[model samples]
Target: MIRFENVSVTYEGADEQHQPTLREVDLTVPEGELVLLVGPSGVGKSTLLGAVSGLVPHFTGGTLTGRVTVDGRDTRTHPPRELADLVGTVGQDPSAHFVTDTVEDELAYGMESLGLAPGVMRRRVEETLDLLGLAELRDRPIATLSGGQRQRVAIGSVLTPHPKVLVLDEPTSALDPSAAEDVLAVLQRLVHDLGTTVLLAEHRLERVVQYADQVLLLPDGVMGSPAEIMTVSAVHPPVVALGRLAGWDPLPLSVRDARRRAGGLKARLEGRVPAGPDLSARPASGKQDPGPGPGHGKGLDGGDRVGRSDGTGRSGGFNPFRRRRTEAPAPAAAPLALVDALGVRRGRVEALRRIDLTVTPGETIALMGRNGAGKSTLLSTLVGMIAPTSGTVRVAGRTPHTTTPRELIRQVGLVPQEPRDLLYADTVAAECAAADADAGAEPGTCRALVSELLPGVADGIHPRDLSEGQRLALALAVVLTGRPPLLLLDEPTRGLDYAAKARLVAHLRVLAADGHAIVLATHDVELAAELAHRVVIIADGEVVADGPTAEVVVSSPAFSPQVAKILAPQPWLTVEQVEEAL
Candidate 1:
């Protein structure tokens, strides 16, 4: 019911600056169908949503050279209020969109806005509360909710209208595995049960690919030519990374489909299903021993990953000259470390209870939990962003609370769930420089760190204009400017494509080999398997399970994947590992 015809947008920049962000773009969405807006960051995915919501010219002060019609009305003619009934939108940042202080009132505000009767509003509010599993938090203040809970309220506020179309931009980027599942389940039901047309704008392809009926490859920059961005196309489902690597034509949209296809293909290729990676034995060095060589990095910079295991070393090493080999990782020791008691609180609600844990260095730690499980709160408290309400958190020998953020910067760097909070600079160079400065190092040294973290940041572009992956890279660049020994990434892979995710994993490996500890909080099981050395399942502010990644992921039936691996989901983390087993 929404259409973009030769639409182009030009926005005024700093001090009367004018530039086009989207070219003459053409797009169409049928009713009761699902479409995915897919591309890298800053590709105008948000701008496309703005066009449908009538916020482009009114709020952005832009020139519109084409037509955007929603529900048959020209977007140019209808104000946002007029179109509010037909379409609902959720921005990428859930915190930025909350309209009220409490979850209950937040849900009711939009209903009241539309002049619904109080009785009708009450019924809808109750229904939405149950639908999103927010009934427990209905009366809770919005400020007290976790990132995932806040996002649920955002979705509920919009769904109350029962609009014909729903638009969500990276709804799960900030959530843990359990909480992300909760929000995604609600969206799935909206399409299958309510027949609400869904248009999701996201870069995290693995999460939504399974359900999308259509895939639109939006353009990368501003211009009205429709030359590159917003290239809409039909897509058949397959697992995102698998399809990309196997070069499957008509990439699959779901993990189930990908599993079946992978099984059949592997059976056809090597006459058997791919066995899981052999974790029983100490993994061979997949690459050369760490020392100065052609591939070795200067100082702490990681050496090029051997592109492929040539019976001597591992693949995916930092080798800019050679093509990257599509392979999986070899199994190694699970990362572990010691912890005494850890606890944190937000206002009156306890974010984390008395907790104890230990993970080794050079391991990927997957912290899985439901919304409000206190995963992020724990991470923040650990990294000194917020002090612990009680107990202690440690990296090596120092407690973060006992040390300043500056001190932690050299030992523990935190990549926030929402990366934009750290990106306020006018330019990429300035932001990276600021990050370098915050790390208490010289600007030149920080610049070198930025090049290593982001790999391809130019000097003149606005940091805001960079891609989602680039923005994360920039934030990480700032976080790691001091070469911290412990890095806590709160969903670093959220909203990233397979390529971007792979790159992030590669970066983590680079840092880990140099002895940095990595703890990632995410809802993505697939990502955890591929990257994490261990898995920790958190429920109700306590770590319910902690073990090797394989042991924990498979033990929890609900969190385990149905993907047909040579082994179950947990034991075999990457495609290369599976292939090696086979």
Candidate 2:
């Protein structure tokens, strides 16, 4: 269905130096097969996906030296509009694909543009709504839909056209575990029942690795079976990592496959306990210790605060079983942020309801839930971007809604879900300079942070020219320049690969040790298990479970990380824990 013949693409550069993104890639994807594209950030994953839909040279000005054919139509000869019936492409950002306000209209808009009959359009729209579980949200505005819901709608919009080949880039990056399963199931049915060819790129391999029949490694653009590619790939899911650690003959892509081969490993770790960071020394007044079991605990009050130590005082490596102690100092007179009975309303919809939360010094709290379960809304309210309909929000003892922009920048810094929302400058250097000027920091402060987060990024390049992961790093650097007491991040790891995410985990840990209170709203379970001291699960805008990381995540099947799921009944949450224990 999809074939590439010695394809190579090069973009125009200001220095008159052209660099090829895809280096003479020759590949073909069979019909009715799901091919997964895997590579590091900026290694041409998105560029390759754009080539399938004729967006590389046609929409994005560049040089196309070879041929890419989708459904027997040459992308070079046929534009995206002409090939719309044969190919459907969904990019990384779902918001960029919406052309209509409501979900129903958005799904039908593609068919309308194709000039399909009214009756046919209606039938396809209904079928797509039921297929993707978007029937209940058909009448809702696209702007109010959650990130994951928006992704589903975007996929539904394309699926309504019934193209021969479906090309998706990170389709399940923002979805919860169950929602991801639903999307994957829909893709599976399309491939099996309808003979639709699916070519997708995803950084979270644990979610989709088992579903793929073939794997395409970018830069090299080599194609092989899933097991063949995953064996030698630098990027892989945690289960594969665990398989390598245990010396399994064949690496397991899914948890079920790994669990069946874990008998001997489980016996080896029978009586071992995860030597995670010490929380016993953390100051908690009038609160009983939840111990080391998986049980819920009461939310900490304003008086109870963890100490803030320097980065040197914390453990150095990623070993989860490494014994370490937090040597942070006591909190000041007031907590960094406080929320009491917080409620927010957008028209008739209640976004947040009666939420009581506190962020003390030197603490990292992760807020997790389904896509539209008020995670983004709560972050916006805390950062003063949205006003609360009722109750109080205080950051550094000042009202967030009433605080001025200058004061708010110093009191709290927020990295929004869309990194582009925080970036406006032309070049990377200019954006860093603006961030430094806005935060009243030294000229090189923001640039240094960017270097620490994303190495080897050119300063002369435009912010939009960078990859999604690089853009996220730049946005994070811009926010961190202010060194605010309370740091708020919404879906910070959306485009980051495993290496980039590991750097982010280390940076956030240092920030937490330096006396900053961090609150992150994310769907990345592995990130929460590694970085957060406390995990808070919010459902329908209310806190459903709040406790230590192991307790909250392990108790719930939907929120647990893959490593925790593989080592069931054991309190281990990461591969490093098991590795160090053995």
Query: Could you tell me the lDDT of residue 559 within candidate 2?
Result: 84
- The C-alpha stretches of model 1 lying farther than 4 A from their native spots are 11-20, 177-182, 192-195, 220-251, 259-338, 345-348, 440-470, 561-571, 579-582
Q: lDDT per residue, candidate 1, 1-582, as tens digits?
A: 888898988755511334566887877777887777776555577778878888777675668889999889898999888889888988766777887888899999987888999999999999999887788888788767766777778988998878888988887676544556667788788888888888787665555655666667756322221112222222111244345556655555555556656755464445343342222222333321211101112233221100000000011112112111112344243323345677665656666776776544554577876666767776776665666666766666677666765455565666777677777888877876676566556766555655655455566667665655667766766666666666777777765655555556666666665656678887766667665666677666776776555556666654554332423433444555444444
Each candidate's number of clashing pairs is 39, 2
Scored by CA lDDT, what does every candidate get? 0.63, 0.79
Candidate 2, residue 57: the lDDT equals 83
* lDDT, candidate 2, 1-582, per-residue tens: 888999988776522355687889998899999999998777888888899999888987778888898878899999998888888989988989999999999999989988999999999999998887788788888877877788899999999989888999999987877778889999999999999999999999989999999999977888998889989998888899999999997899899999899889889999999765544434442322322322112111110111111000000112212122222344443577889999888766787888888778767788987767788888878777778889999888889878887667777877777788788899899998888887778788888888877786778878887778889888888888877878888887888888777777777766665567789988899888877877888777777777778887897888898888988988888887787788
Instruction: Judge candidate 2 at residue 48 and give its lDDT.
Output: 89
Q: Worst ten-residue run, lDDT, model 2?
A: 306-315
Q: List the residue pairs that clash in candidate 2.
A: 308-328, 309-328
RMSD (Å) of each candidate, 1 decimal: 9.8, 7.7
